[model samples]
Target: MIDTAIPHKPNPTFEGLKRNKVWLASITILILLAILSPAQARFSLAFTLDALLHTAPFLILSIAIAAWAGATGADSLIARVFTGSPLLMIGLAALAGGLSPFCSCGVIPLIAALLSMGVPLSAVMAFWLASPIMDPSMFVLTTGVLGTEFAIAKTLAAIGLGVMGGLVIYLLARGGALADPLRAGIGNGGCGASNLRTPQPVVWKFWTAPERRAKFGREAVKTTLFLAKWLVLAFLLESLMLTFVPAEVIANTLGGTGIGPIALATVVGVPAYLNGYAALPLIGGMLEQGMAPGAGLAFLVAGGVTSLPAAIAVWALVRPKVFTLYIALSLSGAFLCGLLFQTWMGS
Candidate 1:
């Protein structure tokens, strides 16, 4: 007898595991290491766990801050800086981008909204350049993984890069080089646009309301999980790199105290970059292997701005000319920042 019963679908748990690329990659690496080199697998696991434990305090603080901001709607304040004079807006936007918690992809919707609302391209460019480099959570994590001084330098670099980009776009915009920056058929960011256009009042004491409490819980869980997976993967990679990659090799390639190494690092950064959080431990490993501080900085800055995801989003959203300008600014700004940082370190 032909039954009309529907076929059972694949297990949800299996499907979820399949979709978690980072975790899958991590597990695969560990399994391969175990099979090929049990000693290295043991060492890598221990290293990853130890690093995670050491970073616990900073991780908790970062998670709380991110979740609190989300629950309280503090992100709305970001829109306020877009008003005022173009120069002032540019400055403020750059500063805000350094401080704001938006990632590269996360900033795209906001960019679309600002561009659609007649906000000057200079200020938008400023925010766009800086938004991916540093944020409160990222700064905290950076301080934990890299040193406080390095984190501070990175934060400053983010703002400086933003300002540089803003100024360049401003001058070119004045010369009529960049008009109608958005690509055709792009809507005003849909859901995210309205939030910027009419921001809701922030509720500082979000715990008072049931919905806000729920939101806080959700945000906290989400942020914690996100950071955990990336950091675990990062520390694991660091362990492998430290064990396998020779110091002399790193030293000879990216270790020299000169602009040449920094430039090479800037170029390498665009493609070699993994994820921003994931890159920290890898950079730490590189530093230990004699990679220069300036090269590290260049890699971080360039990777943050021109990572595949970030660059793709920019290309998809803007006209070709604007996209070209963004790439030019990112590479130049990264090189300049690295050079300045190297000089400062030498001094």
Candidate 2:
């Protein structure tokens, strides 16, 4: 059995503060580290903040959506609806996941609840693959950074990837491959959520409840710290990459329109691409440096789906086989996107 307890204890560094306070201290370290480096800490801070400003609206909306859904017992109800037609459910789940504003962390609790409620694996896989890639806010940001065409292509690609993962998961289920879908602790609140089961009926006044407000505050802080840490690191790395990596080098190395570039792109993308928002300016920089259009798409698709944070969230909730399937689907979809784009767009 996987012991998924989140540790909570006091230390000298933290004194009497809680876990959230520890997170805040860690974020402060990141800022201080930024100032000491050749990364041009001030500029990186500015860049990261600008990106966060743009992302704040989407982040808030995603949280609100999840909060309301949880408060109203809508998550499991929606899951039950997907049990009838797996194929159609897959499609709709993919679209809805792509459009949903939640990040991987924001959606983790919902996933745990769905699994506990016996949601079909097919729909769950679709939602998992699509949830972290693109949302309405992500779409607008991508369009501004890359272009309208790139943005549309990315949106379509996210849905397509979700569908593909859904089908594979469905087949795996039919074959009796996995003995279980939810991991040892997932259904029992190992996903760090206590109220996964059906709770007391919450109405429009859910927001007015004192306990509900406290829960929301905790979630909000946790999410902000999670996002802020990764984004700060991502922006710092992006700054370093921009400063050291030259345009000519990027063009000559990754500019080729072939299998090699596509493979290389997806592989690097799995690790290099951090946050969807931070990836935009970095990718835009690459494009300006004559990076191949297809490669750019491949990079974005690959990284967005398989980013470390997103992958970690999945790993925590799922068994190894399903986790492997998620990565496989992401890489394959990225390669396919690269091929199609290069063939048609000639980039």
Candidate 3:
């Protein structure tokens, strides 16, 4: 009982009229199309749900880490810690990396902040290399999926690799072969007045510094936007890899000795941006299908350390060669850790 005789008044604006017509035409086409391909429609919905499953954990971890960094002043603390003696810095990095659940993606900003705060490059490298493999989140994930024994062994391997890598970087860094745009007193005039930007006044002027509020908001916004943008791409790619690529292919290709494990881990993981939680279920599935524990461990560590987005984030702060070294160091550390896990720990 619609009034088809009279012309219904539509939005007079050009843009509004275009929008209405587009919506109507789209709905009409969809209605006709639905009658033709119901099975395809159902498949599309299922595929979407599976993709969401693959992406959810990575998204959650990234957002949570961003929130934590904003809340805690961990960035500044890391920077201050980085300013210590090279040996002490490396040790601290190993300790901090061992404990924190933060991944490479989340750690980049913290390292940048640390650099701004004056932490040594070696220490930052140590942390970047180890945290993803040795952190509690990764530990729980490895233990739950692989086993407690595997997790413990993996942790030991991470620590050993991290320490050795830190020492190597510390020694090599003295030659100044690597470029470090983030070195102390380079940018922002040694983190003095330049970093202390425009201030916003608060209720209690005497109690709190206006500078802190301004800096906090700026950093929070910056970090959130940066992480969020990368996370979307990471999520999409992760889903694509999980859904399309056969797990067996990955396992078969990456498994075995003679640096095959390391090479495969690096090549595969450099592009696969997975957080600790996002990886566990997928890894569990792979392991059940006969993926070697050591190879799987290597994949997890490499994936976390060599995340493309995280590398880019870090490259924004440091120079290209340093970033390249970071990738090489993380990949090497992951492979060595995997080997050690396979060798030393009791079966």
Candidate 4:
């Protein structure tokens, strides 16, 4: 109030930023030096293989499903309906989540891209809440790694949590707290053709018409290409994590201590961002080595919800407050799900 006309001077030098860069570079150099030893590299490679094995099945399935959703307009239909009704959206999201391989990190980029292109918040949230636990990759890997009992328990737990999470979000933002950020950005510019209002095409009546069939086929091709463009990078990044990270380290860090595993999994995953496909084999190995099923679930849920890229993409549309709330909501749901698994299914 006293100095309204005075200009504030910002420091011109990026010294703080420079220091951070130097520190990060030093750490990377040290890690590389350690890996230079053949023995250590071999050990690292073994863990990498386990991670890759865990990730493979889920990635393949999720990509396939995403392609299907994109081509058939299922994603757009689901988004439109779910955005209007959070409860139904959540249930659908939870159910779909159970069968996908995107994990938290992998899901984030793809989901964020979908949201950017007009997917509903509820469906996106559902994917966040459920995908890690529900995938075939996780089911198969955990069954082999931790036993059939654990696998069955995990699948049930994921569905339960996915439904509950979606419900909670719906209740919290019932009157539109969860507006579509991408749609908001569109204003009147017609950003997302997918999100635009168009005359309903006559479906059954047009089924036999060659012109309609051709149009539908063209739309399918376009949608598939759009989704694949966003997903390819996620797949490649997941592969890199699988190739380099140590499964033993993850297992040990996330293994036990009751809820500590859940909390640590949520926190640790903020950066590591494991793909469900890549995460499965590694988690299986960990369970084989005595890691708790609850911990594995936490890793899966938290890792999917806290992806860095997803956060960045979402921030573009929603305010920081909404994005932070989204993260908190997603993580809390994941944590609760992990605990639920422990409470009901633990050995």
Among these predicted structures, which one has the highest lDDT? 1
Better of 3 and 4 by lDDT: 3
lDDT string for model 1 (90-176, tens) is: 999999999997755458988998898899999999999999999999999899989998999999999999999999999988998
For model 2, residues 1-347, the per-residue Cα lDDT tens digits are: 99899887758556533445534643564567566762566666666677668656655665455455545444333333355688988998898778765546557887777667777878878987887788866786676667789988888888988899889888888888855777886775434243344434545565787776666666656555555665555555565567679878998877877777777888999988867866877787787777788888899999988989788888988889888888998999888987788777873
Best by TM-score: 1
Give the worst 10-residue stretch by lDDT in candidate 1: 186-195
Q: Which stretches of candidate 4 lie over 4 Å from their true place?
A: 1-35, 39-86, 97-124, 131-162, 174-253
Question: Candidate 4 residues 131-188, lDDT tens each?
Answer: 6556664575456545677677667666776677666666666776766554244333
Off-target runs (Cα >4 Å) in candidate 2 are 1-83, 189-236
- Candidate 1 TM-score, C-alpha based: 0.97
* Rank order (by lDDT, best first): 1, 2, 3, 4
| TM-scores of the models, in the order given | 0.97, 0.71, 0.59, 0.56
Model 2 has an lDDT value of: 0.73
Ranking of candidates on TM-score, top first: 1, 2, 3, 4
Tell me model 4's lDDT, rounded to 2 decimals: 0.56
